[model samples]
Target: MLFDFDGPICHLFPGDTAKRVAEAQVRWLEERGLRDLLADGVREEPDPYKVLRAVDLRSPGSDLVAELEEHLTQQELGLVATAMPTAYVDPLIRTWSAVGARLAVTTNNSPRAVGRYLASRGLTECFAPHVYGRTPDLHLLKPHPHCVRRALDAMGAAPDETLMIGDAPSDHVAARAAGVRFLGYARNARKAERLRAAGATHLVGSLEPLLKVVYAVGDIKAR
Candidate 1:
């Protein structure tokens, strides 16, 4: 069995929310002339994720996040990507399925969000009835392992036969708690190191390296 989402199948889901938050922060900085205090030659298109994550930290007790969320609904936040599909995901799933691996998704995001993007990408039928999202599974969010456990149950997969790949620390941690091995899909190395610290058994900077895992090791070979 295989499990991976977020950076592998898609990029961060709240991309538009981050963009709005970054614009808001920039405006907030300019309003207070804080931009003037920065060193020279700092021009660059601001990364909305970094900008918003910083804001999220600066105002731990602030209602700003809720305010931001109110302005950016679930659908408003685009599931933007930093990379195109490394290879046709359908072939990978099909190959793995023939090798006896069942594929499924367990994401903290609302089920509708996944449906929305997959529908947009024309990749919905690939997963079949194996997606578990927060839409109706609110009680089983990530970092808790309930969703993954449910997936295992549905697949009739044992922990040893299951391999989880994800791009975040929570993804690996959740896999550990659910008793499975994990590979850190380090889409961004700096961020993925933190997940490594949390016990990601292996790291793949990009999906192109899957040939090594799926073919060479004969480990988790395509179904």
Candidate 2:
């Protein structure tokens, strides 16, 4: 099983932290007279990854893009201390692991941040060497599936047999492109609507139902 870091596992920037990070990115550009690099939509976008993507779109493989990505990575690492774990995810991961599932994290967030957060939760063993995350290449970020593909390759898991649980439309697109089944995790109505619009047919509003299924599977294995 593959999980997206920011949503399916935890809320890395719970409240306005993500917004603030986006704003800071904009400000960082403005300070360097690079505000014109952002489009009107991206300038005010609250999602930090979008801001980074916009910069990379305008200047692919440029030092400026690399610097912006690094900055975002630093911001994410700082947030690990305050990231809120999704309810029922801890047991869900452990139960899945105990039941012989090969777990991995495929996310746009930095792998360092993912590792730190998982370690903090004492869940590192559930997904260790298979954690795939962002690189300096912003274009490879999901909806691109670079990280997902990496996870699949590293684990030697076939696409059809792998299931990816993510919270965004980009994740859906990426999973589809990689030929992996997708399970959308939408925590609210807005997110569910977005996933629906993105063509996600199977979705859950909470992880509890998934946990229940895993427990049942474990029970079956025990018997």
Candidate 3:
């Protein structure tokens, strides 16, 4: 199984993002009298992407990334984490692993970022050391089947026998391209309709509800 890590496992940006770290950047800049940073007539309000855009003063790319990195380093950002194992996650994975369901993560994020978060959340022990990412396989992002195919190859599993469980359209598209089953993680009902339209085989919001499906009569790998 290939799982997308962000939304299902953690809330990186937090809530609607109105009062998140993105908002704090402007405040941080202002405190330092860097009000000139907002001289571009950029957003002073919280509009999700607007606050983020303002941080870069509307310019894009590595420039934006560098600025954000610098800002985060100076500020004490908040991170809400589970005190224990992510309740819905730990058992399901160990169960699946026992049942011989090979697991992998194929995300657009760099391996460093993934590793940092996983280690912080104490989730590093969940999988084998070979947690694959774009670092070694930048050629394939989630929208492409290259990474997914590679994961299956690593496990010696064929496409038809594999499954991709994720929260976005790229998950479905990649599964389709790789001929694997796509399980949509519609954790939010608001996005459920959209994922359905994208051709997801099953619409499940929580990882807790997936074990039955994994070992079920349907969709099992054929010998």
- Could you give candidate 1's per-residue lDDT for residues 1-223 as a string of tens digits? 5455556676553435445545655665567655542334221225433443344445543466444333333433344333235344545555565555577887765456556656666566666578876533223456779878878998788988788877778788788899988877776767577886887768877666675455554554423
Q: Name the lDDT value of residue 71 in candidate 2.
A: 91
Error of 1 at 186 (Å): 0.3
List model 3 lDDT by residue over 1-223, tens digit each: 7766655555544454535654677766667666565645453564323444444443444454355544543332234333223337655665666666677776654455556667775556665654665532223556777767777878888888777777777778887898888878786787688888777768877777575665562335543
**Candidate 2 lDDT, 110-213, residue by residue in tens:** 99999999999999998988899998878899999899899999999999999999999999999999999999999999999999999999999999999999
Scored by TM-score, the top model is 2
Please tell me which model should have the higher lDDT, number 2 or number 3.
Answer: 2
Where in model 2 is the C-alpha error above 4 Å?
A: none
Given candidate 3, what's the lDDT at residue 188? 77
- TM-score for candidate 1: 0.64
Evaluated at residue 116, the lDDT of candidate 3 is 65
TM-score ranking from best candidate downward? 2, 1, 3
Ten residues in sequence with the least summed lDDT for candidate 1: 36-45
What stretches of model 1 exceed 4 Å from their correct place?
A: 13-73, 76-90, 98-100, 135-139, 212-223
